[model samples]
Target: MPAGQWSSAQGASTSTSDLSGRYGNGRPRGQALIVILAVLAGVSGVAWLIWVTGFHGRPLAQSGLTAYEIVDDHRATATLTVTRRNSGVVANCLLRAYAEDHTTVGELNFTLDGSDPKRVDLTKSVRTEREATSVELVGCTADGQPRPR
Candidate 1:
């Protein structure tokens, strides 16, 4: 491959790897736009993934609630109990629903407090309609108590 070419299944293609930043300008405007958009979208996607990795694939604790869907609001909500043996703080958790484009369109944050109870209420969820569904839970301090939103 040349300095400005990339190896491809078809043949040599534009050297996207040549771009110094998240985007490049070597390709035509349209191609560049597409590449730029795709790359930004991908980078944002991975970044968002990393940003939300704290709760990805995390299972909902049987203590509170299960993942449920409601057609009335086209949303789904669930609660997972988080108990840190080291800290021993409990909270009533509620996680709102989000879309694929990273847009928050439904529900409010769940509340978690050991002093209160171990139940979570998920609401205003959006089905996998337009954006990718996601949840934004409230963060807690070192004491294991959820901080005010």
Candidate 2:
């Protein structure tokens, strides 16, 4: 095109200016992309926190252990007794007692037939009465099968 013909055509486009345009110190494309990614990351983090922590705090257990008698702060020894159920030959019956902070203070190991009511004594293993705080009895097979909870 000739220069004079191009000058005449440009006059018509001069009136079609963008109204909302202003001089701006624009943010770089990298910075804008980083801000967009940060926003998305924050939203996803909140969603994951909500999904992991449900209505209840504890995990879903198939069967909770039946807590029998909770003996705490007993003199010289703490003891927890549960009704002994008749299983096969109970090779090992252990009454493991702990302190208030779940520290193993004493353990009384004994062999008892599941058919009869037996008492496991922690007094023999417990040297100090002050250390005995919380007690729990766990019976298990010698082969590692956890006794019926």
Taking the tens digit of each residue's C-alpha lDDT, what string does model 2 give over 1-149?
76556554565553323432443346779999999999999999999888767622322111121332333444334343333323334545455666677777676665545564433322323342445665555643333334323
Residues 69-105 of candidate 1: C-alpha lDDT, one tens digit per residue: 4444455554444543232344334455666667666
Using lDDT, give the best candidate's number.
1
Query: What lDDT does the true structure give each of the candidates?
Result: 0.48, 0.48
| Poorest lDDT segment (10 consecutive residues) of candidate 2 | 56-65
Candidate 2: RMSD to truth = 12.3
The candidate maximizing TM-score is 2
lDDT value, residue 147 of candidate 2: 37
User: Number of clashing residue pairs in every model?
Assistant: 17, 0
Task: Report residue 18 deviation for candidate 1 (angstroms).
Answer: 59
Model 1 whole-model lDDT (C-alpha atoms) = 0.48
TM-scores for all predictions: 0.30, 0.33
